[model samples]
Target: MSDSINIVLRFALYLDLMLLFGLAAFGLYSLRGQERVSGAQLPFAPLLATTAVLGGLLSLAAMVCMTWAMSGVSDWIELWPHIEMMVWETDVGLSWTLRMVALLLAGFAVTLNKRWPTASLGLVLLGGAVALATLAWAGHGAMDEGARRSWHFITDFLHLWAAGGWVGALAAFALLLRQSEPRLAVLARTLTGFETAGAVIVVVISVTGVINYLFIVGPSITGLLDSTYGQLLALKLTLFAVMLVFAALNRFHLSPLLENARQTGEHRVAVNALRRSMVLEFSVAVVILGFVAWLGTLSPEME
Candidate 1:
């Protein structure tokens, strides 16, 4: 029961942080000058602020759960000292402290978003990145020692950031498509920009993914096939492949159709198709995150 709660909390925290960072970064890069101004385009500021607050709360809950799991204590009073020890005397605690601080700054930055859009976005982006990257400290990377630990953390951080970028952009695309009457030109530009960004994100995720696998499972295909961790990873890769298919369809087929629809002023069909694809992609991303949360709880050796 406690394990289940921990996984759920981790999944929520990961998704929330990703969306908070991804959405803010997308607005900064995809939207043009006046479009970025408050209320001129997508309402990213409030959304990011809300996500940051939620992520902060989830982070706190996750910490409590972690302490409970480690200390084997369910009573709140009994758990207090254990929680304090974890918070003040461990790397996980240090990382959690950093994440909370970043989340608080991100939340505060949202208040300034309307008045200082550019600076606010930058703050949210930086804070979100730091908060997300700190998760590496509590994962498999933290199990290692010396320089290997550093390398593992670096790869883990990159992997999280790249995944966040892709997931967040998908969310932005979905929201844009759901708008009452989205601007065709703006949508077109956004799609084009996402395509470019997607390419880079894919490369980073792929490279870091392979490196992470090598670190976690080594060069043994047999190890992968024989272990539960390997099997779950295989499932994750399969879902990722399906997501790629949807992405490709959006880029190669739906995107061009949107371009034509923009020119002809008959984009309803294209828009609906792209919207459906984005929804599917986002759903798969969430499921992948679930698998990730579960995987994090398991050992690579299936022990």
Candidate 2:
């Protein structure tokens, strides 16, 4: 039961932080001129702020749950000392502190979004990155030492950011598609921007994924089938591949159809197709995140 709670918290935290950061980053890069300001069609600012707030709350809950799991103490009064010890004397605690601080600032940034769009977006982006990066301290990377630990963390961080970028952009894309009378021009532009960004994200995720796998599971293919961690990793990769197929359809078929439809001033077909594809892709990403959360709770070396 405790393990289930911990996994749920971790999954929630991961998804929230990714949306918070990825949405902000997408707004900064994809939206242009008036599109980014107060009168913009998309409600990205409010959505980002909401995600940030949720991420903050999830971070707090995750901290509590982690302390409970580590100390094996459930009573609030009895667990106080153990929680205090973890907070003051551990790397996870320090990382949690950093994430909380960043989340607070990010929440504040949302309030200023209307008054100062550029500055608020910048703050949210930076804060989100910090909050997301801190997750590395509590994951498999933290098990290493010295230089290997540093490298492991670097890969983990990059992998996280890349995954966040992809997942977040999919969310934004879905929301945009839901707009009452979708703007073909705006959709085309956003899709084009994502195409470029997605390329980088895919490359980064692929490279860091291989690096992380080597670090955690070494070169043994048999280990993948023998352990829970490896099995979950394989499942993640399979889902990712399915996502990739959907992405290719979006880029090659649906995106081009959108462009042609825009030219012909008839885009409902393309729009609906893209929307359905995004829904599937987003669903797959969520499943992958679940696998990741579960994998984090198991030890690769134990196999």
Candidate 3:
């Protein structure tokens, strides 16, 4: 059914948004904290800078997909909805254009790698705010009316910020394990900090996601189990649960191994494991984005 397909699609979009922002957040945090400890040998500076630029490009693509997915056109009408006109028009439909510009600047700032505290911090704040705002139009708050909408918006924003910061730090974590690299000690410290930050972000996301479902999707338990929106939501939750599994492995099992290896002056295995885990996380993130995209298209039934 079209509805079924839409549900699947929604989950993908959600995953994509989370992954994209997650990568950016990690990049920003790493750029801020990791590089100082990493010394000049490790390429944390340029890596984070490139990730920021990639995040900008990804943000643009996501905005376009969001626009196309939301026109409410079913069947073939969905295929051709003034795509040509949008291309030619000077006035873009979404406010995300400004976000794209800001992200581009953020990318530039990072690449320049000077006075990063001010430039990078400003970019993170602005970009984070804009990223959160985009969720409103992406339907985080739009389904509800009045104060409920406001509540939904705030919760979703917090959820996003938390997730972004948490996941974004993963990039920094990844930078630590580059063969027999000497930055192992520095990487260990950075990873420890990220572990703490990630915990806080997870708690925020769980709390906010629950509030969103309660206020916007209705308070009944049955609503979460029986509806199309509920099913999609459940699926997102499931994927997140799986992501947490990998996160746990990395945090508890692998991270300790990495630290031990660093202390022992044996680094290759830990680094490789870390790299593999990160890649898996990234792949899962993509699937989650597709689901989110589909979620934006579905209506949470009120009954």
Candidate 4:
């Protein structure tokens, strides 16, 4: 039961941070100039501020949970010392401190949205990326020592960023397409821009994911099916492939359909088709994140 709760906390925190980073990045790259702040593109200030605040609070909860599980202390009096020691002495503690500081500054960044929109969003993106990257310390990479540790950590960071970017864009798309009267022109442009970003994101995720796997599981594929971690990873990879299919469909089929509908005056049908696919793709992405959170808790060898 405690393990389940820990997984839930980790999953929530992962989702929150990924969205916080991805959404900020999506706003910066997908939208242009006054379109960014006009309330027409995205409600940047309130949306980002809410995520930043939530991410920090969730981080605290997850940290406390980890401390409790590690120290086996029921009383606050005893747990307090353990918590303090972990916070000041360990690498996880340092990462948490940096993440909390970054999240706090993300709040301050949102305040600059009115006058310095670009800088504000850019800072928010940077903060979100940092916060997300720090989660690597809580993963399998943290169990390693020496130069392999650094390489693994670097790959983990890149993997997180790439995955976060893809997830964030899907969310932004679903939100935008959910409106009563979707903007066809803007949606068209955004989809095209996403095609470019999506390609890069896919490449980075694939490469770094392979590297991280090699670092953790080595060159062995024989024991993978016997381990719970590997089973979940297999499921994650299958879902990712499904997401890729949807992405290709969106790029090849729905996108072109929307373009044609724009000229033929049949916007409703085409837009709805694309919207359904986006929602489904986003749903699968969330499921994959859950598997990720669970896999992080298990051994990839024989557990």
TM-score of each: 0.97, 0.97, 0.72, 0.98
lDDT of 1: 0.89
- Model 3, position 246, has a per-residue lDDT of 89
**Using alpha carbons, what is the TM-score of model 2?**
0.97
Whichever of 2 and 4 has more TM-score, that candidate is 4
Q: Show model 4 residue runs off by greater than 4 Å.
A: none
Alpha-carbon deviation at 181 in model 1, angstroms:
1.1
lDDT-wise, the better of 1 and 4 is 4
Q: Write the per-residue lDDT of candidate 1 for residues 144-169, one digit (tens) a residue.
A: 99999999999999999999999889
Best by lDDT: 4
Question: How big is the positional error of residue 248 in model 1, measured in Å on the Cα after superposition?
Answer: 1.0
Candidate 2 residue-wise lDDT, 1-303, digit = tens: 888998999899888898888888888889876676644756866787788888878887888888888878889999889878887899998888899899988888888877788788889889999999998987889999999999999999999999998888999899889887887898998998788899999999999999998888787787567877777888889999999999999989999999999999998999999999999999999999999888888887565
Q: Model 4 compared with the native: what TM-score?
A: 0.98
Q: What is the lDDT of residue 173 in candidate 1?
A: 90
